[model samples]
Target: MAVHRALAGICLLGLLLCLSSSPAARAASKPDYLILTLMWPGSYCASTQLTEKCCKPTNGEPAADFLVQALETYDSTTGKPVTGCSRSCDFKILPLVNMLDDLYTYYANLTCPSNSGMPHWKDVWCTYGTCSSLNQSLYFDRALRLREKVKPLVNLGSSGIIPHATKSYSLEDINDALVPRIGFSFTVVCTRNYILWPFFYDDYLSQIRVCVSSDGRSIIGCPNGRESNCGDTVKFPPVSYPVSSTVIELPSGDEMAL
Candidate 1:
């Protein structure tokens, strides 16, 4: 009985030590809001290089849909997007292996197709999760949890925002269309491309980013009147798979090799 009591005490001390050492255990001046950036695969693939492997259906993925690009936070005081807040701890994604299947298909880093394209999730976790109120494990788990809560893609798709077509949609019309489901102020950013030379054309419907509560529970209002880049009447064009010769650097210091 005495030996058992001593062992129990030792275990408790180890656990306490771990908690103290982890950033999530310590108090932090949390960010004002979370910016959930959802990437439209059609837009992403359109821009992705041919060398990069795009996210595929985890299990007969119904459609080439939206991917969670960056689950970031906005610093109200600094007026800039928060990134690389802390790197004191090494990121270990082994624990997240259980969700590997879903992560690859849903929030993929098409730039890095290796290891089922987990680097995308890793980049976001290491850069932003360290600064979050939750720990490493809970941070990712929360993202997955938050994603399951909304059905914006389906809602938008049902509202005639389908793939392989171009149509002009007004801001008010989109706001009303999504308010019923998303129930929050969100930002819809679009991408434009010009054929160049003899002619020029532009496209839209690149991304739809939504703001989440700090606690990661509810989809909240757009912070500081954050507005979309599109005009009052915007074009919703089909996703383009444009191959870029230049590589872009991700927030986690990762570069999408061209």
Candidate 2:
């Protein structure tokens, strides 16, 4: 009887070890989908209050178009973000040396105290990218590829939605421009320009959040459905800034305001 009990305990331990180390188990723990957030720099810098001071990259001017703000992971079943999946960040910039230019152009770190955008990349990789099935190189590469595929500015311009300081476009106008081109619905986020506050404020187009499949190949409707605080119309401001200008100093707020 004693021998049988000991053998049963060993079998249970082996089973647990096998389950914990299984590839299938690791894949199951990954997030169901990714949200590629493309932010409008003009609107991001226009706010009177900002959590991070905006600045141009030390390398050079970023592209005057929507930039990749974040590529976050979420669980469709729980409707919550999946973060801190791995303790081994082990991030190294050497692996990303080839794509540094594209990363600076599209996924820039405009935050104050501008340095190379390595810190921002590391944070994203440690927080969200580690949770993904992709390795570090593939993770950053995938985001860059997605940004190219979306082409937010080009699609919007094709539908007569060019940026203007004074012009405002309806939500429908923005949606029609992007959805058909991207072939999936996306959330258009807006922020109130508090720079002109106390007198008045304008809802400026901020970020566009699009859902991508786990494999990062095809676009899919956000499982949580469309989310927007935008009114009927929102201004599409031009991306104009002086070199090393003090763009914003908003009060403390959520990093992911979406």
Kindly report which residue pairs in candidate 1 clash with one another.
Answer: 45-241, 46-240, 46-241, 46-242
Q: How many clashing residue pairs are found in candidate 1?
A: 4
Q: What is candidate 1's lDDT per residue for 1-258, written digit by digit as tens?
A: 999999999999999999876665433445777877777766655643355455443221223567677777766655466556674546766566566555655666555333335455667776877666667666776676666666666787778655555567777777677788777667788765545733654555677788887767678876667777765665654544433232322223232220
Q: What are the models' TM-scores?
A: 0.69, 0.79
Clashing pairs in 2: 49-250, 50-250
lDDT of 2 at 136: 84
Q: Highest TM-score: which candidate?
A: 2
Weakest lDDT window of 10 consecutive positions for candidate 2: 249-258
Q: Tell me how candidate 1 scores on lDDT.
A: 0.63
Backbone clash total, candidate 2: 2
Worst lDDT 10-window in candidate 1: 249-258
Stretches off by above 4 angstroms in model 1 are: 1-30, 48-63, 112-115, 166-168, 196-200, 232-258
Q: Taking the tens digit of each residue's C-alpha lDDT, what string does model 2 give over 69-123?
A: 7788888887777876775667777677688777877888778887556678888
lDDT of 1 at 8: 100
